[model samples]
Target: MSESARTHTRQRDDASGATTPAVPGTASFDRLGLPDGILRVLREQGVTVPFPIQAAALPHALAGRDVLGRGRTGSGKTLAFGLGMLARTAGRRAQPKEPLTLVLVPTRELAQQVGEALTPYAEALRLRLATVVGGVSVGRQAAVLRDGAEVVVATPGRLHDLVERRSCRLGRVRIVVLDEADQMCDMGFLPQVTEILDQVRPDGQRMLFSATLDHDVDQLVRDYLRDPAVHSVDPSSGAVSAVDHHVLVVHGPDRYAVTTEIAARDGRVVLFLDTKHGVDQLTRHLRAAGVAAAALHSGKSQPQRTRTLAQFKEGQVTALVATNVAARGLHVDDLDLVVNVDPATDPKDYLHRAGRTARAGRSGTVVTLVLSGQRRETSQVLADAGVTPKVAKVRSGEAELTRITGAKAPSGNPLDGGPVAPRPKNHNAPFRGLGSTKAAQGGSAGRPSRRTTEARKLAEAQRAARVRRGG
Candidate 1:
């Protein structure tokens, strides 16, 4: 963790978790006091050494001390807090509708990711962990809660709905975690996140591996976390020096050509667009040009979004065209390139989008195609992010663009319509966006799941039946 580790463990009582005297830590997970079962699981997964954030936070977390841990994306934040929560909830028989541990994330992708990361450990400890996110069947999530689950990983908005329906209870939750606290707040989940936290046990241990511990997340720390043991592994912004940051100046008329060329490059790459409309437009163009592109945004159903990601990861889709939804919590293997087709308006968005690459100590490049009118603003955003990128004026099919991003011309022929999954005919109608307001509730990016419509109708029917039965 040498190159990746710029960490310091501290303890503070103030609202702003700042520097203070050092908190002692160990280098190994076993030495940090993780249970044997968890250590064995880690070993089985070939995870031997602890990341800096994990080393700094696990000691406090395992001891039930509230922890505020901050690290760059892909820095083992899940393991930092998840192991302790699982250990604390182990051997406990949760009553139906009441979980012993709660993990609240900002997105459906993140909830699923955290669940997948923690599953083996929970299984080793004999704990049942449920991931509750919108986009799929609400009845399935409700049934899991209705039966029994020791741990629940969720997105706030859907969790609120479940609570209102009385299908889940937070009263028994003694360990609460907010995975991306800053993103949760930025996405306006603060009220619901706070509401959910308030419902958990008063003395519950809280931990976070946040994107930023600056302004947006301060309220969460002041209100929920007790005089916590805090760890800041990276700088507040989480920008890495190893990443190749580039700002490519492109003329508006040449933008589409440049984008298509990059998408047609020989390797897999993620192309970021600001809006769902733009993402779809570019994806369709790429497919027509035989680029094997897929679109991902909040306007797609959960299953559609899930399938898109699977295709991207499995190499079935060569180009991933997306919006801010995939900016956070989406991890792909060997993904060495990310092209910001539409420059990010905010520094955090830029950082998160750039984070999709350069993960796990690998070399990656972030290229932002800036319009002529966008240079000044994009420069300011980069300055705010503390990154000095390699700036160059690039045009479509130019050698400079090719050198920087491996850009090349696409095939004249169109793909056979297998790159991006075809929209479901019988399920959700082709939503220009993603889910129903009710089923797609929360800060989740895509809005398109017919599964949500069916689930909502089922819930309403169940309630109507309950009213008739007087149960």
Candidate 2:
């Protein structure tokens, strides 16, 4: 397809996704200029309206101009670039072991997500899409590519591994997209990205999308992009407006119970914990509670990660308990809730975690479980991040929780029938000061010495102190 024709295809859809028909002076998809076939596909998929990112990047991305997009995760990035990739590669014939379009992402989960998002649109035009990542066997990906997939979405490490092993080639790649470029830098994947980019055709189209473009990302753009068009739809300054954030403070003993209650009645919940062990433990507990949950962490094997993600997306698992693994690259639709079991140490981490919800302007909730000790630290983080959440104590089985979550309480007490333990008065006794040691010696050990000395004094002065004074 011609570049001009491709650009027009993505820009044609500007309608809001609402079901209500457009009135006079109302925004419509016709304003953006998408093709009727693509529009039909979107409508069938219940995507009638355009998200801000999609509206902002579609036009330039489709035009085959190297576009730099600045938007948060779940801000319709996949569709934005997916439309661009589909529009550009529509008429191109698939070649064996060579892809016409390539999408580079940070993590395996994201690669699969992007592939899934674009698959339906690619299928409309009979374009093939293959996922290449490290966890699964590369042989399967090689076979799929050999069968002639037009597009390839892959993680940087896995994709580079494939290239080094001579399992894949990028000489025919026409469109190259680096989604979540900032995240790649954070994960130390720049070398892999640089290696992968060196192999792709230099004269081909390149589009880079990220939440924020820092020095490292700028370096990639300067070296890779050719007079790239920049589009900043919600830059760092603009990220907060798109997300709704809240912090819920609870007692230390009631943390897990509170988290379980919040996650139980969610739409799609990406529950983030501080550590991998937490992820595994939370997954087990949630599953036992009849709330289907899948654990995603670095400890899992590749196939396990892939399967867990599949179940999560398919709604077989209502909650996905994860560490930082799902923080950066994941883009899920209609994520109704984001429960941070442990509040993020910094505001940046908080923003990344909160970004999972409130994506695509669909309006979602972000509830963070802050135990007693975490209140001050988490409060500082949120304040620095410029987020203000309604602070309230969560009563485990109270009416407020019921109002917030429509689901009823589980049969028995969710706290494992343990009584709340009061904090010890001498909390610092284990590391007590010298005064405490001296007092202990004087009170017990010193008493015996004083009594023995006083016994001899009493015998010597038997009747010497018999006088009494009257006032």
Model 2: clashing residue pairs?
7-62, 11-32, 12-32, 12-33, 12-34, 14-29, 15-29, 16-49, 17-49
Top candidate, metric TM-score: 1
**What is the per-residue lDDT of model 1 for residues 1-471, given as tens digits with 9 covering 90 to 100?**
464466777789685747577567778877776779999999998999887888888888888999988888877889889987888888899999999999999999888888998999999999999999999999999999998999999999999999999999899999999988899988999999989988999977888668677788888888888888878887855555558999998765566677778888988999988788878877876787778889999999999999999899999999999989999889997899998877888888888988889876678999998877789999999889988889999877789999988988887567855454322222332222222223344534466478998999999999999999996
Whole-model lDDT values for every prediction: 0.84, 0.71
Instruction: List, in order, the clash count of every candidate structure.
Output: 13, 9
Local distance difference test, candidate 1:
0.84
TM-score of each: 0.86, 0.76
Candidate 1, residue 371: lDDT? 71
Error of 2 at 239 (Å): 2.7
Residue 66, candidate 2: Cα error in Å is 1.0
